[model samples]
Target: MHELIAAPFLEDFLLLRPGHASGVKIRGHHYLELRSLAAEEGPLPGWLCRAAHRRWGLDLDAHGSTREVVLVREPSPYGHGRASYEVNNGCNWACPHCVYGDKRHEGLPWPQRAKLLHTLRDAGVVWLELGGGECTIDPHFADTYAYAHDLGMMVEILTNGSTLDRPQLLGLFTGRRPYRITLSVYGATETTFDGFTQRRGAYRKFRRGLAAAREAGLPLSLSVVVTEANAHEAPAMRALAERYADRVREYTHMSPTFTGGSDPLAQQAPDYLHHRTPFTGCDAGHTSLNVNPFGLATVCKISRDHPIPLLREGVAGLTRLGGIADQALRRHSGCTDCALQQSCTTCMPLVTLYRKAGAPLDRYCQHA
Candidate 1:
């Protein structure tokens, strides 16, 4: 007998791909890809049949006697709940442990970036973070922020606060301002700050920028990153950070270089360098994604070397990227019975490092 096929019944929201992967949520229950849903043979659920008929005019009726699967690809609303885009890859300060490392400065043009932002907003991306070598340093920073703001998206900017005091840059936030500005505080003192950044008088510039942000009435927070060089001063730094903003965040762990292993200039700290609780797995590509200056989306900033161009493939591409990230999360055989499993930063990327270079797991582990 000939096979009977019924159109796929996708939920009202977008489905990135099979496996019920990440996508936007509109109303009601979550959406599932037809191909994946059909993989399981059984009586069709009433909800799936109803949604197929009502939303997409798809009648998911397999011949009364036999069942056949159906698939559909039509223009659908995408759900980009949250996203972070690196506006440019040109940092003013070169921190020794910086992983960004020599990435080309091929930022998307202003016009193209504006379109990308609009597309994201249209696709239901609610929370957007604009960051970069330094987002404010980008020539089109204001234009991009204004466009994102006008689209009804909550926008946030991450910067080192080097140019926050610039009159021209300050003007952009004078009117509506972003949801918040996250300033990375390198050190509590000028000498340490300048030493870490390798920029003469950067500390002074950062202070001026902080004052400017306050003057503009922008909501602000401080991010104090812990490194071996600055670990001793974290307590003092946290105290200073609180004075600047009520909300302060501290990062105690540094991952391997994107190229893998230690960077000559941006050296990776010892495995037991600064103290941090062990991480079981990474949520990159699943809960969040990082978009580089060139619009390549990847697992996270640390995993930028492996990236997928998000604009070209949309949510479907995200599905593939998520799978790659998930594979990276699979536990190594050695980790199954290890005593330090909970204390190791033993995620997929780290496992790739261990397998590729044969580096001691403890070398990349956050805990001793």
Candidate 2:
């Protein structure tokens, strides 16, 4: 006989076989195990154990819960099972380097959005990132965040930190301690920050927002989008973030200019285009799925305009996304045989999107 803890939230991420195991959570830690193990059944499949280790770093044989393993190593419990949804695509700040400007936001209705949350929970999604041009600016932001948390998904918010301290929003973080927020820092000083944002006194508002989040004891993190203007102060910005945030991440690779037109602020560094890494594979539809506010689930945030809707289809549609990715790979036969296959940062869906958009693919083409 094998004993398992009862944790309903982990059912999808853990892949526990029905009738074979049970779930329970104690002190925020989920414990799980097989209901019965016969001598003839042998040990658990090696693939299952390996996947758990790779994605979550949990040792199923150890009998200890993921809570113990993850808390010691990371600040949040967002162990690999992540999916990002753009609650809305409208941003308060017109940052020159923004990536999703071309994709318009239609706004997912509250009823549809609520249903999608339950569908995601059913699909075994544990980590849900609420993002957009800015998640806070969305009218349904509070309701959506509350719904995600209520469904037992570990919620993460990606924002510019300009609205973190609103008194009305304080009630959202009342229950959980592991909730996370990612604040993008433009520069270390008020002058540079305001200049990058192109808004007078924007820096002051940002500082106030960061202070509000810290005071609320939210699990705050900072990210600096490296650009020609702010690259010099990257270190200083990081140090500044360390003062208030629990963690900091850096985005050095600048995004391609959005499809519509040229924005001087959104232009990427020339060097950024040349620095390539091996195109291993993408986790877009397989491990992670990006959903637009219109309730359409595409391969990734960059390819959000694609018509593949996973909201209505639920988790069953993931198989379709996988097939789409496979077809994309087949379309790019040269990628497989290329000498720079190991160093190619471009992926199949991205190549397809660029081709469809009639955009210049040779820019990422190392041969050129």
Candidate 3:
């Protein structure tokens, strides 16, 4: 119920509002000002009251006291400040393009999930993304989401939009307000969408959810996934998404499953397979990391080689993550001898998956 959250974000400090994307970054005297104000027992200073109103459309004075503001004075010892957590690898629809091959409906119960969220907060994660085979379908979706929001982390959800229409879910989101909810659009029409998902009435459900989300005025983003099944409707999908969301993105390339299975690659639309830009570098483990449902931490979602056991080792386990990221990004066996290494756009982990799957060279390699 705190209106304003003051916390350390890496080297900087942030004054964030729950359910809102816009925030005020403060340091030096400004940070000191808010810190002092948060410690006071009276009504908030007029400047802060006015600033909150002007910035986030929040009227701090209406709250009547400084108790509405929460400040985290302790700086996190961990370097990473962002993470993507898979709430569960479970989904309602069975899309062939899903990167997670097996849709197992399993995740930590509320108690364990609460501990993991606390760990993430203590580990300096300010921006948290909750995703999965379909995170909204997770039994603990509402609980996990509300807890993360209360922890003062800006939360983003990656969902398939099937469950968004539920009255309970709409009420939850309306109350807490996610930073953003990104939904994937498989197709524009019911036949293509349901066929692509291999589930009957999927498109109808998706539209219902989309309408509910829109009506709620919750922040929305859309991902138009172009696959062999839906490529013909790509333009329509984009147009439909644009109408519903403020931000719309189109994704054509399909990657292998996290377990190095190429099952998803079969859904790739050939005409949409454009060459990627040259591989430069990434800051996965250094700045961000990925965590599975069971609390296994990896450098990133793509490089899930040797996962660090977060539950066992705690935050200390993340110390070895940067090294793992370095190793995973390095040029591996196939790319080591390639003459076009500099021009090769695919990263090493992806190249490894491509090789493992016996996929067409043209899909990832310059040699083709």
Candidate 4:
């Protein structure tokens, strides 16, 4: 915990709140309330030690103790250092459980896209996450990659891996990038994948893309979003992930329901009622901004109201606006309760899906 606190870049990038401090209060009421899990000099208190994990999203406890949810310093306002450009929402796959099917936003102007990249570069963003509805389909996809590379930032693409074979996709590297390609692979085989993604040739095409990415020397990782169609294949899927090496990761745990544009927690899982949230605080509103295609800084990726135009004013302006700005976010309970609070990304799309799925307990919760 001290190391993270001492790290120059992260310290500047994130604002860690001392437990119970009266510093900038985002939570309704605040005061130091936690006890250290260990002796101060012996080891970190449980809350502080397990504060840097990503597992809170899956309801998995990183702490050996199952007694605590994570908490984090409140997030720095987003769009300050770098902007998260959400290109569009329409995915090539029509996965049965997909919520964005009806809400995918599209058609971004090229200039706006150019300005977005330049803004991130000028801000000294160390990491730029290129995401979708489906990012590769963006008209300026090649230029976007080149621009990110030119800005000298490490990039990570959260893609479904459809058109990796396109000449445009290959042009992203141009021999000057330190990039990571992530595949939101629906499944491990054609039958399994098709059932989950609803994209007929996606599995094969994804493999082709993986081959291309490997040949390009770009690091690759597979992210399997566990759902009804793919849960049973966890073991086999995990084996496949190993083939991709240390980079492959399986993200099981239910997503918030997105159909009809509902919150994931509200709907709950058919037979589950367990709810898990990150233990850390978010840097979203301050440090990480999820920009809509139109360049609006949404309270969340799934938020449809109170759109703050990031390109127009930037993160500092959004901070002045104040609050989550989402009518749908019932409360920010998840962040307050998880142990891995500091390093969690509470993506709104997943929150919406989790709400709809009846908030079922995570099926294979790693903590369990």
TM-score of predicted structure 1: 0.70
Q: After superposition, how far is residue 226 of candidate 2 from its true place, in Å?
A: 1.7
Candidate 1 lDDT trough over 10 residues, lowest sum = 1-10
TM per prediction: 0.70, 0.73, 0.95, 0.63
Candidate 1: deviation at residue 76, Å?
7.6
What ordering of candidates by TM-score runs from best to worst?
3, 2, 1, 4
Residue by residue across 140-242, what tens digits does model 1's lDDT show?
8888887776654557889999988888777777664566789987788998889988999999999999998887777788998777676667788899889
**Highest TM-score: which candidate?**
3
The 0-to-1 C-alpha lDDT of every candidate, in the order given, reads 0.64, 0.62, 0.86, 0.53
List, residue by residue over 1-368, the lDDT tens digit for candidate 3: 77777777777888777778888876656666666766775566676677678888876665666656754445678867899999999889999988898999998988878988888888889889999889988888899999998887888999889989999999998888888999999999999999999999999999999999999999999999999989889999999999998899889998888777889999898999776789888889987999999999998998898899888788888889999999999896767787898888988988888788778888888888
The per-candidate count of clashes, in order, stands at 2, 11, 0, 62
lDDT digits (tens) for residues 1-368 of candidate 2: 11212223422323321112122223323222221222233345444356555544546665443332221111122222468888988877777877675535458889888988876766656668899888887889888987776555667888888887787675566444335788899999988899888787888989998888778777788997678878778789889988886577777665444353334333455543445566787666666677778777766676544446656676566666655545555535556677766667777656654444454555456676
Off by over 4 Å in 2: 1-80, 102-105, 257-266, 270-276, 329-336, 351-363
Question: Which digits, one per residue and each the tens of the lDDT, describe model 4 over residues 59-79?
Answer: 233344321322222323233
Worst 10 residues of 2 by lDDT: 69-78
- Show model 3 residue runs off by greater than 4 Å: 39-43, 70-73, 337-339
